[model samples]
Every structure is written in structure tokens, then in C-alpha cells.
Target: MNILLTGGTGYIGSHTAVVLAEAGHRPVLLDNLSNSSADVVDRLAQITGTRFPFIEGDIRDTALLRRVLADEGIGAVVHFAGLKAVGESVEQPLRYYDNNVGGTISLLQAMDETGVGTLVFSSSATVYGQPAYLPLDEVHPTGATNPYGRTKLHIEEMLAELAASGTNWRIACLRYFNPVGAHASGLIGEDPNGIPNNLMPYIARVAGGRLPFLNVFGDDYPTPDGTGVRDYIHVMDLAEGHRAALDFLAGSAGAGWHAFNLGTGCGYSVLDMVRAFEQASGRPVPYRIAPRRPGDVAACYAKADKAADQLAWRALRSLDDMCASTWHFQQRTAR
Candidate 1:
């Protein structure tokens, strides 16, 4: 299967590309490199022992997307292009709407024009605002609290409407939980341009001595350590989940806008991640407890049975693996 992956140079996309290549599917990356580095292509080739093609452009360019679809003979698309910072989105909602929501519409239009229907969209766990239950399921209510989450929820609604309007569409909205870690080879990983937003990366940075201390956001949450807890899935497992989604879509047994939660169905607190990072890197990570950021839930994981039963996919990596792989990549890339 020839797959066109938008934002394929980004963290999750790059890992997914490796998995796709390993699964014997050809993936042509389409990225503007807005939040990622072009050097990832080289790293990918090194890791996979295969050189895949890439297009340096945005998904909003319908003309370019159409041309690429026709020229590359694309059979499916994995949409991963979007701005994803929650705090940043609060500051720039219009940019989030224009890039995330607007880009999806343009991509769908191009796919419709080119007669390509198979799609695996990168959704988020944020759509479930504050979890109504302990472990969030697919049927949970979606009330986005932030602009970034709203963009995700809006695209999901659009996909549902589009699926209702056709039978040829096979779409999967993969709502990812906390995605941490990196490729074991240590060649690529999550590289935030400015200050990191997520806990794992910030912890990694602090342990690596790049940052002073990890800010434990409100160690007063109802969790075991009185800190916030979340479902932290390894990037490798998440990458394989994409492979399973693509395989499921290619099988064509299910139809319409199907959704799956890509998580481990277990929650780990901020202190747990900090300790994991310290153990992984052989360093002591200092921290200070700050007030919980607005809009942050106390605890949120996933009910991953759906993805396991439906897509035949489940996370296999442990928390230690996540931290070790992430630390390896951070150290190697920093060198």
C-alpha cells in the first residue's frame, strides 16, 4: 500500500513511518517542517534501511496535495499535521483553527478529488476535556476545554459527517494519550522548539541537565502521590498502532468514522514519570510543586479494550521502556 503521510516528519509521524516501512507499506512523507526538522528523513532512512520520498509542503495546498496524490499514486493517507500546544493554543486560537481544522478540510477535499478514501487521522485525548469516568472510553462525552482540543473535536465531527455522506470512506480517529519515548536507535525523538509543554520531555530535559527542575503541577491531586496522573504510552507502541489501523482499514471490514483510544489503559502520575526518568538516566531530578494549570485533569487514562478488540492492537511497552528510550534519544540527539 502506498501511503501519503502528512506531517510525517514530526515525532509520532516519523515513528509511524518507520513502522509502516517495516510492515512493507510505502509511506511518502508530506510535511511543511513547521514543527519538525527535515533531517528526520535522513534519520528514517538510516533506521529503516529504506529511502522513502517526501514532499516539502503543507496540507492546505490542495493543488499540491492533489498533484502528489496523482503523481505518487497514493492509496491512503495518515493525517498528522497540526499545531498541538494547549497553552499556546490559548494564546492563538485562530492559528489553531486555521492550521488544524482548515488543513483537514483541505486534505479531505483533495482526497475526494483524487478518489482516495482511506484515512487514519491523529486525534487527541484532550477532546474528552475532564474525564467523566476513571478510564475514558470512545463513547465518552467530548467537550474540549482548550482551543487545541476544540480543533480536534471539530475535525472529528467533520469526519463523522463526511463518513455518513459516503460508503467508500474508511476513517479512523486515533485519540492518543500521552505519547512519550523515542526510537531505540536514539536517532530521533520529540524535540520541542521552545519550552516543553508535556511532562516526560521536560523531565527528560531536567534529568539531562538541560533544565533546572521539573515543575510538578499541583501535587495535591487525588492520585497516589497527590499529583496528576495520565496514560503515558510509548511512541513505538503508538507507531505500531498506526500500522494496525492501516491494516484494518486495508481489510475494509469496518466502515464509517471509527474511533479508537491508543493508550495503555493505566495511569501514571507526574512523580512516577519523574522517578522513571531519574532511574532511566541515572540522575536525580529536582522538582517544585506548582498550582495545577487551568484545564488540567487530576487523572485520565483510557479504556483500551476497544482498540485491542477492534483493531487487534494493544500497547506492549512499559513505563521504564518509555523513559529509557526517551532519555537515550534525548542524549544522542543533543550530542
Candidate 2:
């Protein structure tokens, strides 16, 4: 099957492209290059030995999306194009809504018009907001406290309504936890355009000596380590989850919508990540206690039973592997 990946050059999207190609499917990439680089196309070819179709455009361009869908013979879409910073969303909610929400609306319209409805949405665990219980599951109540999570929630709601409307829409919303690590090849990895918003990347930069020291955010959260804790899944494992989701949608008997949490069912504190990276890189990752980031929760993890039972997918990489792979990429891409 030919699959179109919006924001395909981005971190997770690029990794998923590698997995899908290995699964005997063609991946057509579409990105605006806002948060990613076009050089990823070269790295992808080096990894996959296949120069996949790369389209430069915005997901909000309904006309462009329609043309690409028709011309590329796209059978499914993995939507990953959107602003995805929690802190930035807190400051600029309008931009998040307009880009994340508005772009999805346009993409859906084009897909509907073109008779393509198999969609695998890139949702986030942030949609669950502050967890009422540990190890959040699919049935957990969702009330996003930030604009980024709200955009994902709003998109999921729209997908649910569309699926219930009796159209042939087969959708899978994969709510991801923290996705870290790089490809084992150390060729293609999470190369953000600007200062990293995610913790793992920031920690990796500090370990790589690009950054002076890591800001240990809020060493006073109500956690074991007195800092924010999160479930960090390897990017490779998360990419496999995307492939599994696509396969689930294909083998399903009918059109419907479902959500699955893509995580390792484990939580690690900020201090834990810093220490782990230091161990992996054999570098002294100096840090200082900093103020808590806005829109951050004390602790959040996953109860990934649903995904395992339904899609036969589970995160197999360990934290050591995550940190080791990230350090490898940092070393290889050091400037």
C-alpha cells in the first residue's frame, strides 16, 4: 500500500517511514519543513536505500493534498504535521489551534473528497492531562490542561464523529508518551530545528557538550525523585507502533475508530534521565535546579495493555537502549 506521511521528514515520521518501507509498503512524504529538515530525505535514503517520494507542502493546503492523494495513489495517511510543544502551546494557544486543528480539518476534507479515509493519527498522552491514576489507560478521563494536548483531543473528537457518521473511515489514534532515542544506524534521528523542547534531546545536548548544563526542571514535584516523571519510549519502538496500527486498520473487518497508548508502561524522573544519559555517554552532565515548566504534570506513564492485546504491539526497548542510542546519534551528528 502507498501511505502518505504528513510531516514525514520529522523525527517520528522519518522513523516510521523506514519501518513502513521495510514492511513492503511505499511511503510518500509531505512536510512544510517547519520543525524538520529536508536533509532528512538524504539520511532516509542512506538508511532504507530507497529514495521515497518527497513532497514539499503544507497539510493545510487542501488542493495540494487532494492532488497528492490522487497522483500518488495514497491508500492511507499517517498525520504527524503539527506544532507539538506543550510550553509553546501554553503561551500561543491560537497558533497551536490554527496549525494543529486547522491543518487536520483541511487534510480530512481533501481525503474525504478523494475517497481516502484510512488515517493513523499521531496523538499524545498529554491529552490525558494530569493523571487521576498511575499508568493511564485508554479508558482514562481526558481533560488536557494545555493547548497542544487540547489540539490532539480536539482532533480525536473530530475523528470519532467522522467514524460514527457512517463514512468508510478507519482511524487509529495512537497516544504516545515521551518518544526518545535514535535509529540504531545513527544516521537519522531527532534533529529539531531550534532549541529542543523535549527533555531527552536537551539532556543529550548537554551530554554532547553543546549545552553547558541541563536545567533540572522543578526538583520539587511530588514524585520519588522530586521532579517530573514521564514514560520515555524509544523512537524506533514508537515507529513500530505506527506500523502495527496501520496493519490493525487494514485487517479490521469494518471501518471504525480506536485509540491505543504507545508507551513502555514505565515512568522515569528527570534526574533519572540525566543520570542515565551520563552513564550512556560517559560524560558529566552537570545540572542545576530550575523552575518547573508550565503545563507540566508531576508524573505520567502508560498502561499499554490495550495496544498489546489489540494491535500485538509493545515497546521492547529499555531506557538504557534509549539513552545509548540517543548518545550515539548525538556523537555522530555533533557539530
TM-score per candidate: 0.97, 0.98
Candidate that scores best on lDDT: 2
**What lDDT, from 0 to 1, does candidate 2 have?**
0.93
Give lDDT: candidate 1, residue 43: 95
Give the per-residue lDDT digits (tens) of candidate 2, residues 1-335: 99999999999999999999999999999999998888889889999999999999999999999999999999999999999999999999999999999999999999999999899999999999889998999999998988999999999999999999876899999999999999999887887887888888888888877889888879888999799999999999999999999988988443699999999999999889988888999998999999988888999999999999988999999999999998888888633
lDDT of 1: 0.91
Residue 204 deviation, candidate 1, in Å? Answer: 1.3
TM-score of 1: 0.97
RMSD per prediction, one decimal?
1.2, 0.9
Over 4 Å off in model 2, which ranges?
none
Instruction: Return the clash pairs for model 2, or none.
Output: none
